[model samples]
Target: MFNISLRHSALPIALFVFTLMALTKMRPPNLWAHTQFLLSYDVGTVRRSLIGQGLAWVFESGLMQSTIFALAAVLTLSGAAAMVLFMARALARLDGGAEVLLVFVTSVGMVTFLCNTGYLEGALALVGVAALILPVRGALPLIAKCVLCIVGVLIHDIMLPTFALLVGLQLFLSRDELPVASRIALGALPVALTAAVLTALFLLSPDAAESYDTVFATVTDRALDFPTRKGAVEAVMSYGPGMEPAYDSVWGSDLYRFELIYISWIGVAITLWLLVAAARLISHRPMLDRLALVAAGLGPLSLLLVAFDVSRLLGVAILHAFLVIAVVLLIDESARVKLRSVFTQQAIVLLLIVNVVVGFRPLNGYPEFGDDFPGAVMELPLWWNMPPSGGRLTQNPGE
Candidate 1:
């Protein structure tokens, strides 16, 4: 009874069970363990997802993107800290009851990204949130935030679509709620910003876009598939000239498999969270609960809908939001603490611990590299073309 009872055998057994439990519950690793991958390539979402994955690669290898991403991350972290302090100050000046939730939403998007990714996409997103919540009662605040967001567009084009999405989402959801003049005013800034960017990109040219991507990719090492990336992109894009979809799906098989795993989990968590939220809202429409859901979902669903290529981003965004929402929903509002339900609470804590462990691997194994090594990763994408991974992909990706 006092003996350890053959602990070595139990170690592998324990790890096996733990690994199985995590994989069964989630496919992605680290901070976004609960997330699912996406399928659609809605332009905006694609750019951001690419920014994340591409940046991770560059940072990991200490290759093409290391310097730029390192610099960008530092810059983003600094900028976010400053902005949050500013946002908090700005919030203090406001009087709306929803303003506190607005600040929390801003913090979740800005602060969390600063902690996790710190890519240019996240940085640009931070600026846009600053613009959105800068409290524009008069023209000065509005003009300032809009201008800041516009300026940020050059840093990452992903922000453009996000701006459009936010404006559109607000317009669609609040159309009946807002007066006509308020609607027009709300539409003007984002519409103008989108038009200007589209015109600029249109005028920029294939050669220019290619050149810019190359330079940016070189600088950040986060370029989507560098045209010359010999392994995957080249093998596919280089296929005998006549190809149906310009992308190289042939070389992309491995990438696609990982993509499938990530997207499937995102679907599971999002639908689960939304249904749960809907059910709670239907039963008891508390202002606080509604605020929690709104804040929790805002950035993620926005990114998912606007994503351009990879479904992985949806998986990335959804579970992150779902976990936070689930926590907020179940927590005891009156006690100054709460719980969504027993299941969700356990899931959230377990997920938090796992993600922390996952996050550290990229740092330890890779060291100079930004992401985890082979064994460190639980991501199916990382193990694509392998036995179990390939088998996992057999059933039409997410199905």
Candidate 2:
């Protein structure tokens, strides 16, 4: 019997429109994102080729740059809408204080969507959202969840960490309902399949350097009018070769330093919000539960050591946290009541204000791209922003 009136719905609607406008202004799907469309199974089974292959199957042959960009934008916006709707629906079931916290989290997610437009992460997020929603609604069967996990990994292997977090938390929360052996097998299934998929991608795919050239040529030839960045193309191409090349590329560079500092600041903000929002639910949980939550939440951060895209991994981590919160609120009435009691209207409003003022920067440090307002507060004090050394390769052209 939960009904959400138009008055209650205005915030999410406005935020969605705001996201659309922001994306339009930004004019995203940068060279890197566009390059992804150039890849497909035509070149053989490759990492992150699922979307590209699907696009190719749909479009048949050569596709215009504008068309590719449009498709990417549609996927990004669709994923953003899904996230917003999920939050809004969840918000309706909560009390005032919890509602405000949900808004805070949703706003951050919207900003992230804008920041990551045109990337596979947006689509991956949609898959993640679907996974979270189905289980919460008691509609997803175990076999289906496993299949979805496989689909997510095929879309992009980076999703494995988040999948781990999702599956682990679900199993942990439902521990009492399931037998010990059942829990262990269900939990291990996804991990084993993910490993198998990744191993196949590595062993089956052609040599990295050769495939990189073929992909680059295919992309450039298809979009003769589009200006493709070699670095961005290489960045994606390097995925099949594993993280060693990525590590070597960014290790001693100024880009590495900038990423370290920027993520450090953003990480603090994310940690604060999570602590405040989850304090009630987690504060009184048993030591094992707390440890499990922490481990699951930090799971995505494992990608940071190998990937130079610090913000993207962090963004995934944020999504994992949101999923954890949503699942807890959906199933644990006691936790919800506890949260309502601890958070006051005044404090919630104050936190929301701080969240707005602090704003969010792009996953990459390119200020020239994307909306300029609500820049990170840390940017002012650090003043070390010289757009990272080695120019375009080190700098991600913001989406």
Candidate 3:
């Protein structure tokens, strides 16, 4: 038996989600046409707090943001499982800490590859991380950091501010060899990147926002808000992507919703705990020793950071990952058996808890037949054994 503790791990977080979807139905469907029309247009202003607001105007709904809010919530849940890949790699490096940097490189690379099927915050956050860690080597590291920063910016322009700050760190404080003029020249890159981020956010956010509002409007129009229909709303939201899936073998038909407050608070609490732990280890241990502890700690922070806001989270997760790599080095490469042993246990227990808590319920819904064929477990980094399919989504003609 997996045990109650195991069941309550991250897995219950899914229940939290189901509960949220069930409890709050933002608005009705026909009134959603305006929002949906905007979604079809991919307009930017609508996403900038306008669409959600506008929809509320038509519906008198309160405080509910946009569809992105729901989507972000769903992704936030997915993000927890995503970090398992990073933690697994970090643990595997228990014997070789210095090279833990490479493990990070591999972990981020692999996670990003699997992330959102190739376009997720994990990819962007990982890029930001590479920005900070790659620079320990000065010039070589500087170049690497710049490349990563640029890459992160490209992945999600919102990440520019974070990377831009890092660019400042790498050029001014970290890279001793870079001359003044060269540093100045390099400094301009972040400025340019910042501009790019602003432009993109201004231009694209509206469309995303509008599309989401439309979805919310649609949900509302259907009066899916009723406690009775909550299950159906979650069904459409969780599994209804652009091109529905082929099976509903995950959580059966009774999908649940999450409460954002609970999700964020819990994530924040866990983040703070790890932060405190890592801080203690960093203060006590040697440079290498610190790396191990930090790596173990980074998993939660990265997840929390992204969970809050992609932009801020991207910057922080990047910085944390860099530090996590250093800590990994300290723990895995430590000459002291006692120290390494302590870290090994801490790392294992921490991650195991995380995995158990991030419930891996299958998303139950199909695009075509609505049959209950099992879906694949969310395999991070593409190598872990398959997770049991969690639930199902029956095909609906509504789309």
- Candidate 1 whole-model C-alpha lDDT, 0 to 1: 0.36
Structural RMSD, model 3:
15.8
Error of 3 at 399 (Å): 9.4
Which ranges of candidate 1 are over 4 A from the true structure? Answer: 1-70, 79-118, 163-181, 184-188, 208-251, 267-312, 315-386, 391-399
Error of 1 at 209 (Å): 11
lDDT by residue (tens digit), candidate 2, 359-391: 344543366322322233323444576542323
TM-score for all predictions? 0.46, 0.80, 0.38
- TM-score between model 3 and native: 0.38
Model 2, position 304: C-alpha lDDT score = 75
Error of 3 at 298 (Å): 10
lDDT of 3 at 273: 46
lDDT of each: 0.36, 0.60, 0.36
Give the per-residue lDDT of model 3 (tens digit) for 30-132: 2222122122112223222323344346544332334433433343334333343334334342342322222232222222222222123434445554464
> What are the per-residue Cα lDDT tens digits for candidate 1 across 212-234?
33433432333322122222121
